[model samples]
Target: MFFFMAKKDRDYFLSFIAIVFLILHLHVSANEEADRIISLPGQPKVAFQQFSGYVTVNEVAGRALFYWLTEAVQQPSSKPLVVWLNGGPGCSSVAYGASEEIGPFRISKTTSGLYLNKFSWNKLANLLFLETPAGVGFSYSNRSSDLFDTGDIRTAKDSLQFLIRWLDRFPRYKNREVYLTGESYAGHYVPQLARQIVNYNANTNHKINFKGFMVGNAVTDNYYDNLGTVNYWWSHAMISDKTYKQLMSTCDFQRQKESNECESLYYYAMDQEFGNIDQYNIYAPPCNNSDGSSATRHNMRLPHRPHSAVQLYSGYDPCTEKYAEIYYNRPDVQKALHANISGHIPYKWTACSETLNRNWNDTDSSILPIYRELIAAGLRIWVFSGDVDAVVPVTATRYSLAQLKLDTTISWYPWYVKKQVGGWTEVYKGLTFATVRGAGHEVPVFKPRAAFQLFSSFLQGKPLPKS
Candidate 1:
């Protein structure tokens, strides 16, 4: 089947191929341009470029995941790309991660304005906040069943698809060094997504530059998490000794099904014993009404209670998520961010989807196996905990990491920030573990300076400051 072609004919064929590539390049550039954000509603002027849009992951299901990318403020081209997810199994990264924790802006009280976050993570790397699982925040699937059909596997698969298509839309970042980070239940999402990216890289010729991943106050192993959580409550004096002993005996962490006794005892610990304090931050005040009942809780769900949207405190708005809900639902805000253009959404925007949370199908009992795989692959991994968070406290993280049986590379020591003890750290052979002093479940929201320092250290592949 071999035939010799004339030089002129070969030259023409090569030129035709080059032209096709050029046309495709232009089309991708146009798509990127369409997603560029000139400015958000009530946003202050900033130097970095921003883009927010949706990348369809499944055409048959009409599923698309929403993303908001904030490039590094200085030397944007040289910085690595960091994908930040917030874990509720059904939470919106845009509302929690972007607006409240690490993204560039904080929603103002009026919910119609924005203010800069001095400790935004974008200062060091490009931050991409994603709303995943097709029903969180602005992401959606036309097939209603898709909303109900979500779990670790589908979420990881859809997120991997989103990254592949997103890289095409912004080709410059296709080969950029990337890191995955998140908090709360994202302990599952971050590791699962990282595993997906690793698998994708193994099979594809074009590999993603995924260096490593880090998680804070993560839910690792069910048995360890439950054990450590009970211990933390008792040790912190949040629960009575009587309740702690009952939890240890009644709750079967190994079983997927919970007995009525365990369920009631768990509720008793949170409601009757723990008082009206913020479980996410034990020392911080709850988002409360005038009647002194709690209005909202983060990540963790409690018994149904009624409360108004009124803020009882002066500073550090605990109702920040409320502001995000108002801001993102505005017509002008959606138009500015290029969201909800199709008018396909039949319901109002919410920070977390209650239906999806209730119906989530499968969850791995432990992610320690995935951790071992990534560590063996020589990818940098880190786990951190906020000491004050009762929901998933430092004790829980320590218990989970212990199951890995990793050899300790560095003895435990206090890490410093600005001449103060920021946290304690221990470097394992394959992973690093650290704690933020007096910080809560949302580390950055409570201890931004220390969180920023820890982030900078992670990106640089260096240990936290020893002095």
Candidate 2:
């Protein structure tokens, strides 16, 4: 067919093709600019820029993941690009990581405004908060079945696609040093995605300069996590010794399906014996108004902080998620964020998705193998815990990491922030473990300054200050 064309006609057709390509390129560039957020409602004046929108991960599936990128506060081009995910296996990074934890702005109590977080991670790096798995938060899919069928593998694959396609939108970040950070179930997410990037970079021209990952209060090994969790409850005096013995004897932590005896004792320990204290933070007061449903959700792995204010962290607002829900659900807020443009969400914005949580299909019982693989790959892996969190407690993290049997480079010692003992830390041959002294499951929320210091050290590849 090509050989049949006249010379002049071939040149004309080639010119037309070039013109169409230019138009398409301009259209995409325009869409990128369209996603820029001039300012969120009630947002304080800031020098840095913000952008939020959806990146379609699976065109055939109509699955698009929402991302909010907060550029670094100073010399953005020179800063690294840090990607953050919050773990519910089905959670909104926007609600928790962005609005509450590490993002630049915190939603005010009135839900009418925002304020600066002095410890925003973006102060040092270009922070990208992603709401993943297609059904969490503002991220959505036109295909209904995609929501019901979610798992670690699919989530990681989609996130890799998101990062790849997202780079097409913001090409400046293509070669930037990237680090994956998350907490809780992201213990699975951070490492899994890092593994995906490692494989992808090996096989393809499209590479993500993924340096390492850091997860706080993360769920690593089911066996070790459950074992350590039971011990933490007993040692912390949260549950009766009898219940602890029952758990240890009846439950096989490696078994995905527990025996009836194990299930019963587990519920009893959490429901009856653990009492009304906030499981996320043992010493902190529970939200009086919360029905306490979150504590029992998906084996108590969900964030248990609820819709009531608490005085920790200098007025650490437990209700920040609530405020986030309110603010993001507003039509104005959605429009500004360039979210839900298709009007296909069919639900209010939430910090976490109960449907995805319940139906999550394939969870790797342990992520430790991936940790080993990535560690050998020489990724800068750091695992930290908020000591007070009973759910996925520090003991659980310690137990899980000990299974690695890595050589210790530094003995355990207190790491200080402003002359106060912030937490304890130990450096292994390839990984670092640290604890936030009084923090809960959400370290940045409970100890922002310390969390920031920890993040700074991670990026700089420096030891935590010993003085």
C-alpha TM-score for every candidate? 0.94, 0.91
Per-residue CA lDDT of model 2 for 191-297, tens digit only, reads 99999999999999878888999999998888898888888999999888788787888788887667787778877877788776667777876544466543223
Q: Could you say which candidate leads in TM-score?
A: 1
Highest lDDT among the candidates is held by which one? 1
Runs with alpha carbons beyond 4 Å of true place in candidate 1: 1-21, 298-315
Looking at model 2, report the run of 10 residues with the lowest lDDT sum. 302-311
After TM-score superposition, the amount by which residue 404's alpha carbon in candidate 1 deviates from its true location, in angstroms, is 0.5
In model 1, residue pairs whose N, Cα or C atoms come closer than 3 Å (at least 3 residues apart or on different chains), thus clashing, are none
Q: How well does candidate 2 score on lDDT at residue 83? A: 94
Clash pairs, candidate 2, are none
